[model samples]
Target chain A: MDICDLGIVDYEDALCFQTDLWRKRVEKKVPDTLIMVEHEPVVTLGRVADESSMIDRELFEKKGISVVSTGRGGNITYHAPGQLVLYPIVDLAEKKRDITFYIDFLEKTAARALNRFGVPAGRDEKRRGVWAGGRKIAFIGIAVKRWVTFHGVAVNINNDTTPFSGMHPCGESDIRVTSAKEVLGRELDMSEVKRVFAERFVEDFGREYSSQFVVRSS
Target chain B: MGKMELRLPEISAGGEDVVITLWHAGEGDYVASGEDLVEVSTDKATFDIPAPCYGVLERMIKKPGEKAKTGEVIAEICTDDI
Candidate 1:
């Protein structure tokens, strides 16, 4: 699989770009690709999200931020510059068409990445996403068409956590949001972090599905 | 002066379709931008869709608990002003 790192981009533009690329793949316009990037501080409402998911819309508007309703699965989550978002435009039919297994693999990859950073992260029994110390660090939301995957997870690394306070993250009002920087208590190298994450994703996904696809670094 | 169909933005990592679970507003109701328009459910979770633009909801082609395929028009917003 080819990995393309898009760097930092506007939230809406990134989503739009991914959607367009996803369409092209579905229509056989392009080869299956994997995209990685980060988005500006934006509040994304997921497939099962509601207005109640946001703590204060007025507050977000006052700050000149945008709220987007997306088709990805999961609740509301914050994506910002320090967070790494991965969009794997892969044909799931070539692998396995199990949605549940895909989600599990994503969680496992995220948790493994966190573990490499010396932080203990795992999946919650009842909740989705990867958590560290009972606080969520990575949020997963994705869509699949004709077995091709688009959109992906956002792992908070060096991102500011203040904006997350404006929403009831993942639509769960009781859950607290955390980041790798907060857990590590220092800034992390973005390139290095992405390398580790990409590696983990490729390793875990390949092993689970027994696919021979290599994770290309962007 | 024409009606614009409002479709669900693509959200799946695999780019799959979502199902309309509920309609927060009814047909003929006025909705402001960012207001809840409909609810969608996927395998991972259910999501509430917000109005993309401020206008009167002209019609709801899909009802509650109905399957809303991606890029399919679930409703239309009548925009005479813009």
Candidate 2:
């Protein structure tokens, strides 16, 4: 896997980038890539995001956050500067070929990275986000095309969590969205966080697991 | 000529509700090999199941909004090749 560092980009432009890469990946033109970015404050709604998942548009509008509908899985979620968004353009057909495993892989990667920060991060299967001290800290939302994957996890390393209050995150009504900064009570350097996360991801995404290993592990 | 069976492959981990979201190829429509035949949602995301071979879509066993299982024949295609 390769890393593409795109500092603070608009969500739509980033999506276009993913689409282009995804097409190339399907065409065997590029290898798997991980794109790390910080997005301008925006709310993205996925396949399961319904009217019930989003209640107050005014909350976003008052804060100048744009809401977008996406093809990725999961529900309404918020993103902004200081949040580390990792979009892994991967080909699962070349690996395990399981959606659930891929999602778990992402959650584990984030959780282990958070552990480095002493955040006590863990996974909640029901809500599908990594939690720390009972507060949701890292979010996972992904999309796969022709067995190639895109649209990935967003970890709250130092981002503002105020916009998350505007919607029911991941369609869960009673959930608290916390950040690494809130959990640690100290601001972190964005570049360092990205570096740690990328390293953890590359490590956890152990290469060439046997087909039996994938079925058994997953 | 052969009738190709189009089944929903194992897209999710296991036991996650997989639903046929939509059909990209209509019945009687000519579909190329590897063309996306349908869109299905599993684990809350959507992915396409491609046609295995160039053929005319002879039947659609699964429709949009219907739950599907892996290896379940979702469609049948009659190939043009001799």
Candidate 3:
């Protein structure tokens, strides 16, 4: 497995890259991969996302935040620079061919990674993401095709959560959103978070992550 | 010719049930081996089940949105080769 770091890219560009990698992975052209990327502020809708979940749409437009609908299964979520999005393009046929287990693995992987940063994040039994201090700190929405996985979990490291107030996070309007910086009361280095997450995934999931491409935001 | 059962695959461990979200091949549809035959969703994720062998989808024991246990037969396919 390879972990490719593509820093601070547009959300659509990252999705396009994920799609290409997903195809390659399904076709057995490349090894399983985990892509870590930070997106330019945007709000995305998952497969089951509802437009009514956005409480204030005009506010997002004025702030230049784009709304996009995706094929991943889940609800609405926000992304921005400072957040670490891990898209794991893996062939499940090569591992445990269970969708439920894969989803749980993703949540557990993020929670374990956050633990390394001294943030005690865990999953809410009724929810689908990682939470800390009674607020969600990570979100997961993934899709699988031909037993291969794509679209993955995102952890809020030091990203802005103010925009999240305008929309329901994963269709739960009452949900409070937080970040690693918010919990620790300090700004966190995005690259460090990415590195910790990559290492934690390898440790927790027992997969070899090859470091091939590393890009940093200028 | 005999009918081969298309069992609800071992979707997960611990014997959890999954909901059949959709059936790509209806009864009487000729499906090729390795082609996607149905879609099933667990609590958080959705995945497709491919045809086990080239045959005519003779019967559907489970429909969309129906709950099925892992390893339970969900459909049957009539094949001369088998």
- Local accuracy of candidate 1 as per-residue lDDT tens digits, A1-218: 66778899998788788888877886777876768898877888877788888888887899888888887877888888989888888777777665666777888888998899887899986888899999998888876655678777888899988888888988778888888899989989999988898888777777977742443222
Backbone clash count, each prediction separately: 22, 0, 0
Model 1's chain B TM-score?
0.87
TM-score ranking of the models: 2, 3, 1
Candidate 3 per-residue lDDT, tens place, A1-218, comes to: 69899999999999999989988987899998989998999999876667788999998999988999876777889999889999999887777666777788898889988998899899878778999999999998887878788888988998889999999988887899999999999997777888888888867666421211121122
| Candidate with better DockQ, 1 vs 2 | 2
TM-score of each: 0.73, 0.90, 0.81
Please, what are the lDDT tens digits per residue for candidate 2 over residues B1-82?
6898887788766757687876887899999888878888764567877888888999999887788888898899998662
User: In DockQ terms, which candidate is top?
Assistant: 2
Task: Give the per-residue lDDT digits (tens) of candidate 3, residues B1-82.
Answer: 7889999777666667777777888899999998989877655566678999999999899987688998899999999654
Candidate 3, which segments miss by more than 4 Å at Cα? Answer: A62-64, A207-218, B1-5, B22-30, B55-67, B72-82
Off by over 4 Å in 2: A207-218, B13-15, B80-82
> lDDT order of candidates, best first?
2, 3, 1
Model 3 docking grade: acceptable
Native contacts retained, all candidates in order:
0.20, 0.62, 0.48
| lDDT values for all models | 0.80, 0.85, 0.84
